[model samples]
Target: MKSSTAQYVMGIDFGSTTSKTVILDRAGNMVASAIAHKGSVSNDGAMVSMAEALQQAGITEADIARAVSTGYGRRMLDIADKSYTEITCHARGAVHLVPDARLVIDIGGQDSKVIAVDANGLVSQFAMNDRCAAGTGKFLEALARAVQVPLEEMGPMAMTAVEHLSISNMCATFAETEVVALLAEGKRKHDVLGAVHAAIASRTLGLIARVGKREPVVMTGGVAKNVAAVHHLEQVLGMKLRIPPDPQIAGALGAALFALDEITSPDHADEEDRVDTEMAAARCGTPTCTAKKPLPANVHPLHGPALH
Candidate 1:
């Protein structure tokens, strides 16, 4: 890959609620990564993340040899040389982070997906819940509001539950109503939050079943940082999960790897053609279907200082 004169490559994930960027050196090592929360599929968010990543890597945009993009707004980035679906990028990125991972469970802001990967980091099968926000971060955000708790505090409060409570097993909108009803019944906020997290675990398990469960499962995306969600998932799966230090950037990292491949791999053109067709088929062909839904007020997917 270093045979090319290019010194670095870049990958951007234009997610609905957040944008992520990753920069890699010629040696295929990640040099910098950044995440920005700016409304749904906002171009400003993408630019912010890319600028932060480049600044952290101490490189100019001119220094990057190639760039690839993935996620909801993948095609919206004019700077991207190529684009891939989240399924492909997430599978590739997860395997790169956890080489022994045979299963990947990615619960992002808008969707939840389970991918079955082979030893070579190739996706064997995958399943996603994109129809609604039933098992996603947005769902938790809605429940948090209904329970009158901060989004960031829901996880810890849920861990303190002493009773098992149940929320409506419907869409996020309906679930919020159920949460309100539970609170009206004098249920503790902690127990109600517990039910909310457990519900996500149950929905995620259904996705896992579709792709067939495998060992050494890896969890990625914003939800992996949620302690209660992870705990509930582990209890339900009867196994522990491997979480990367920075789980949100897995898709962007995968995009960076593909950018590297574009410079290094001999059959890159043919691979690009194949992925283009797949991306088209995966699209819902409707603006509203792909548009970013409004996130809860005062909610930010990223926590603390940006990772360099």
Candidate 2:
């Protein structure tokens, strides 16, 4: 709560399954970051994660001057000074990680998107496969379970495949059935995993073509961590992909960059946010405000009512 601590900012990306958070100092350097599963990705989850990150940074919530949020749960976050789409945040995050990247492909928990970045690092055009989970991380997660491969070990297992089997279906339920049949036929787990990765890669590349792509491509999102998926995507695209240190946090980092911009830009100097406090109080008037008490410590402004 010291005056010097006011130079920090926060950004949160609350995706369907995972929520990412990034905190930056006045110089726009990352001070702390975190990712958490969505089972608690709402207010409590974000607060818990933020609290943890603050603890690591040896700071507190009062140190954050502004907070920007993005992703599916942004609206529910309530503490955000502003909200932006994942596309913008991802584009910014990519450019920060890879300054020369012209094309960015992000395959997240719920969907996949390919974005073209302009010279100024803005998103120029984009394509998304959001109608279903056909070409996304969710598909890979389900396939991993069906193939009896642990989520983190899938990439390595696929690489061990002796035969490059092909998966013709991308629909989750249908693909699950196909995998079940393959297992019944005594197919090798390695081959099944390879097929799944290849199918996802092919589908994702096709999506990129729909929006058009450029060179110096970079991949973001949780899916990018799958070495097999990245390898397959490289083959299908016939190019190399620049990957950040931790792909899952790209959205969060981008949002933090935006917060830095908003804070440092003189034009927005007076635009300090009071939204989090206003929102916490507004939601307190509801009947479902169980416990109906103020939050603990600095949490009182971020979460007003102890709703059930």
User: Top lDDT: which candidate number?
Assistant: 1
lDDT of 2 by residue, 147-215 (tens): 777899999989888886777645877888888898888889998888888889889878888878688
| Candidate 1 to truth, TM | 0.86
Q: Which ten residues in a row are the worst by lDDT in model 2?
A: 299-308
lDDT of the structure predicted as candidate 2: 0.80
**Top of the candidates by TM-score:** 1
Residue 28 lDDT (model 1): 95
Query: Which runs in model 1 stand beyond 4 Å of their true positions?
Result: 1-4, 268-308
Listed in order, each prediction's TM-score against the native is 0.86, 0.84
| C-alpha RMSD of candidate 1 | 9.3
lDDT of 1 by residue, 181-214 (tens): 8889998999999999999999899899998989
